[model samples]
Target: MAWTWTLETAAGDVIRRSEDFESRGDAESWIGEAFGDLVTDGVDQARLFEGENEIYGPMSLHADE
Candidate 1:
């Protein structure tokens, strides 16, 4: 199984995915570094998944700027 990240808008529409990762930690790490830029680019939240199973998130990445 692999993990992935999804970036979504405030309206809950998905914008992108991190493709796949062999480890959840790697997926989380990628998102950690990416969320800031994603927010700036108009993404409002993030979600994590393991295969087809939702693991966590839709957590806010939005920041006042």
Candidate 2:
């Protein structure tokens, strides 16, 4: 199964989805590089998935505020 990521707003609305990644590490790295911009764009949460199965998150990108 391919790994992918969903970036979301604080309200739990999906803002963007990543293209399929070759590995979980690659997906995670993409998120790390993109996280700052995502937060600046109002994405307060991020979710990871392996195909249809959610691996984790709605993890916070914003600092506690």
Candidate 3:
């Protein structure tokens, strides 16, 4: 189970999406923080989606040596 954040422009023409979390709470929190700034300007709305396998983990990790 994971969470996804989606942001659509005011015109609903452009869309931005991000997903890389294991907790829905974390995802929504991030979305709120990010969208809060955009909304102050022109962003119309923001949405959060939660479901199983919405995102995959083991996300590329690299050691800097």
Candidate 4:
């Protein structure tokens, strides 16, 4: 199954979605690199999905304050 991320704001509003990934690792790595820019663009968190099933996250893009 393909992996993807649903990017959202703190209020759970969807802002953007990621491209489909070949593996979970690839998805995670892309987020690791992109989340900084995402945060700048108002993405507050992200959820990972494998096909129709959520596999991980609502992971916060912001660091602890």
Q: Pick by TM-score: which candidate is best?
A: 4
Clashing pairs in 2: none
- Greater TM-score among 3 and 4 belongs to 4
The digit string of per-residue lDDT tens for model 1 on 1-65 reads 99988888888899988779999989888888887788788888878999989998878885552
lDDT of candidate 3 over 1-65, digit per residue (tens): 56775555644543565666677778767755665565655455545556634333222111231
Q: Number of clashing residue pairs in every model? A: 0, 0, 0, 0
Query: How are the candidates ranked when ordered by lDDT, highest leading?
Result: 4, 2, 1, 3
Can you write out model 2's per-residue Cα lDDT over 1-65, one digit (the tens) per residue? Answer: 89998888888899888889989999999988988888888889989999989999988987775
Residues forming the 10-long window of minimal summed lDDT in candidate 2: 56-65
Cα deviation in Å at residue 2, candidate 3?
1.8
All predictions: root-mean-square deviation over Cα?
A: 2.1, 1.4, 13.1, 1.0
Question: Which model, 1 or 3, shows the larger TM-score?
Answer: 1
Residue pairs in steric clash, candidate 3?
A: none
- C-alpha TM-scores of all predictions: 0.86, 0.87, 0.51, 0.94
TM-score of 2: 0.87
lDDT of candidate model 1 versus the reference:
0.84
**CA shift of 4, model 2, Å:** 0.8
Question: What's the C-alpha lDDT at position 63 in model 4?
Answer: 95
Candidate 2: misplaced stretches above 4 Å?
Answer: none
